[model samples]
Target: MHIFYTPDITQGTYTLSEEESKHCVRVLRLGVGAVVNLVDGKGGFYTAEITSDNPKKVGLLITDVKLEFHKRNHHLHIAVAPTKNIDRIEWFLEKATELGIDEITPIITDRSERKVVKDDRLNKVITSAVKQSIKAYHPKLNEAISYHAFMNLAFEGDKLIAHCIDGDEKSYITDLVQPQQKYLILIGPEGDFTPDEVNLALNKGFKPLTLGDNRLRTETAALAVCFEINYLNR
Candidate 1:
């Protein structure tokens, strides 16, 4: 089933945006009375039928809708420092959305090479991923914030930091988080979190965790913990 992102769709009748209209009518050649599906990016899945094949504004009639589709047992949020290579960070955003996560934040750290990020572009990548993966829930892309500022946000359940620094401060993620619990994992940049940053997080009650024996990049490590959390929940 072809799925479209229709955030503005109402209960009975719906009109596809110009972009979606063109893709449905001109490109995909879906005509009137055709069965199609939609996602509202709000944990809603809708099955709709094309009522008018206008190339600029295809109209639809809602046939069915399912809420909380593919709902996960846990809410996973990963806050990581954006890499200098923006492409790598973008890749992480895309894959993480497909794998299913609740939220993502770009942590600005002292060791960070790229502090500024374009949220619009990053969100677009996430939307594309959600549509491709046929997921109803859209991952929330939070604004970039300093590592110091990020720790101040109020969050519930597991709060973890994935760092490579040595000493008796880190546990493998598998041992750290219990299954099916809300979690937020912080990942640092290519240079890793500063000694002071690690201490601050630890002092704030953030559990120190390691991905595995091998050192992984910021994106890889964040994705690893996300995967593990969802894996363990199953």
Candidate 2:
């Protein structure tokens, strides 16, 4: 079934946007009476049939609505430094959405190679990922913030910081991620977090953790932790 995202689907709202309408009516050649699935990205999944194929606005008559769709047990928020290559960061966002995440924030550490990101573009990537994965919920993409500014946000759950520096002080990420609880993790850039930055995070209450023995790229490390969190959820 073709799935379309319509976040504004509510009482008396059944029209697809101009862009989605063109894709459905023209590209897909779907017409009246065509069955379609729609997601509101806030846990509302609907099965609807097209009533009008106006190429500019495909109308719908909702057949069924499933609220609280695909609810997960925990919330995983991974704050990662944007990679120097924008594609790499985008890849992380796409994969993380498929794997399941509650939120993502771009954290600018002292060694971060990239500092700026377009939240609008990243959000589109998130929505596309959700549609491709057939998920009802879209992970929140927070604005980029400095490391210190990020620490100021109040979060309660397992707090962890994954870094390259290895020692008895660092625990494995898998061991630290608690089940059925909200989690916030920080993944630094390619150069990794400066010692002072790690210390500051620790002082601010983020626990030190490691992904594994081999050093990984920024995107690779972020994905590793994301996979680990999903595993823990399961």
Best by lDDT: 1
Candidate 2 on 19-84: residue-level lDDT in tens?
999999889999998999999988999999999999999999998999989999899999999999
Query: Which RMSD values do the candidates have, in order?
Result: 1.0, 1.2
Q: What lDDT would each prediction earn against the true structure? A: 0.90, 0.89
The worst-scoring run of ten residues by lDDT in candidate 2 lies at 165-174
Compared with the true structure, model 2 gives a TM-score of 0.97
Q: Per-residue alpha-carbon lDDT of model 1 for 6-60, expressed as tens digits? A: 8777788899999999999888889998999999998889999999999998989
- Superposition error at 187 for model 1 (Å): 0.4
State the local distance difference test value for candidate 2: 0.89
